[model samples]
Target: MKTMRIWFGCSMGLAVSMIFGWSYGFFAALLPMFVLVQADRWSTPLHVQLVLEIVWVTVQVSLLVGFFQPYPLLMTTAVAIMMLFKCVAMQHKSTYLFGFTGLLIGSILLNFASYNFFDIEEFSINLWMCGLATAPITALAYFLFPEPECATPQPVTVNNEVTKDEYGMVRQAAMGWTVAMIAYLVFNLVI
Candidate 1:
């Protein structure tokens, strides 16, 4: 049942994205899949919140890139700090929404800014559209593949709890941030 929901949600998102010819449509696909798999309950307000999260991270990256364009050292330092915070927050599961948005979506926007692409605004708009569409795709998935009533429902997110896996979580976050840094370097060097 979970697998079916994921497949249906992702396929629907991808189909809509493809139909619209959105270059950043993979975002649309990915968000719905994640929501379907992770969240037991999703609401209309969640969609709005997700969109706002994307926009907020977009603004943060844009500001960082805009102000620090001339100073590689300053830009890198600031971004690195921000990403480190995001990584830690994500690992801690404290403010998962912000951490997830800031780490993943923010990094994408930062990469785009680094590339100095002429059509970046277009791409950002496409990304925003994808975010907006994610809620519906997830909602539709729920409608089409409702969970069996016999199964206990999980909350949307787990409360932050102390676990023995701190080292593993930190390692994962470090790995993620390292990849983001490498991608940033490649974009800067390539452009």
Candidate 2:
């Protein structure tokens, strides 16, 4: 029920971003859409969802990065990494954090390699911008779907009452998002 509204908001944001030439915005929105679709009670099977997610993401990336002379192998690897991270992130606790960390490491390696191998300055900047955009988009999505524990309070009382584990995790993730955004900004300024 509530998921639909979140998905719509994400979709609309992505559309607006694309229209305004912010490719990263479109990719950022996909995170929420994938989350919303995964949360759907009547959602399609896992295989179907994976197929659609991959196809749509691939299409989006191809269109967004089409202007650049992307290296085929690197592009493939990047998309593969994104798909894997998205799949894992759609699951239970700590998945997003782990998946994103992996994606970031892979991207840093790839982008650094691209810069050295191809002498392209824009790839690093684009990667940083992607991180900046992803931080907010992910934080917003987490705020909307949130973990069940954080989103609801248990009636059971423990010294009055203690919130669920999801609350702690979600709060930590929210805080991390701010750090990530700040780090991205600082790095962008420095680099």
Highest lDDT: give the candidate number.
1
Error (Å) of candidate 1 at residue 185 is 2.5
Model 1 Cα lDDT, one tens digit per residue, 125-184: 887899888888888888888877856676688778668576798798899788878887
Score candidate 1 by TM-score against the native: 0.81
lDDT of 1: 0.78
lDDT tens per residue, model 2, 47-113: 2433343344434443424543256555554445454544346334434433453344333433333
TM-score top scorer: 1
Q: What total of clashing residue pairs does each candidate reach? A: 0, 0
RMSD of 2: 15.0
lDDT of 2 at 66: 51
Evaluate residue 15 in candidate 2 and report its C-alpha lDDT on the 0 to 100 scale: 61
Off by over 4 Å in 2: 23-25, 31-92, 104-121, 134-154, 157-191
